[model samples]
Target: MTDEPQRAGRRTRLYALTDGRTAAPHTVLTMDTTITAAVDAHDGLPSEWRAVLAMCPAPNGRAVAEIAARMRMRLTPMALLLGELADRGLIHHRPPLEGAETTNVHLLMRIRDNLARI
Candidate 1:
């Protein structure tokens, strides 16, 4: 069997390629005498996703399937939601794993982990 630490390193790298989306941005409505927010704003993301998103330590990006699994749905549904967000300028959909920033974050996480073990 491979070393546990090395296997963990590979697992970390695998997950690195999955992150690509950003967190949903919250728009600030005017703080007037009366402020009305959507049910979602007060309620937060659908229960399923709220927990899953919370579990994401890095708090950015997701593989299509990752979101779907959280919602207990299929990839098609997640794709639709992501598309809708992008269309509404609420979120951006990245091309697969093209973002350099995600890679940097992933690398940083790996370094942090390795350092912690030393």
Candidate 2:
């Protein structure tokens, strides 16, 4: 049987996961972080990493947030997976233009309070 149904189901799940409101969008996946496939071809990647690698645009690469959105995965877990792939030399992950920043609890709390007000 074709894997079409399985692929479609996966896409559906990704959509559902990404549709909900999240507290720290910036923390998970941000526009500036770029992701590129390090290998020439999909040879020995884990299935999940394969899916992530597939989502990355060739040559130009893709933003981390875009991948997370397409994959319908939470940014935190996605970040971990990406990190693993990068460590394996299967993918390249570039920090955002401004460089990575440590999480500031005060800032997050402020954003959360503001969002709650809306």
Q: In model 1, what is the error at residue 31, expressed in angstroms?
A: 38
Query: Alpha-carbon error at 28 in model 1, in Å?
Result: 28
Q: lDDT at 58 for candidate 2?
A: 64
lDDT tens digits, residue span 2-57, model 1: 11111122222211222443332333211111111112211334433233333232
RMSD of every prediction: 15.2, 11.7
- In the range 1-118, model 2's lDDT, one tens digit per residue, is 3211124333433323333332332333344478888875464634556667666646767666556656566776566556555656677777664424437677558646743543
lDDT of each: 0.37, 0.56
What is the TM-score of candidate 2? 0.53
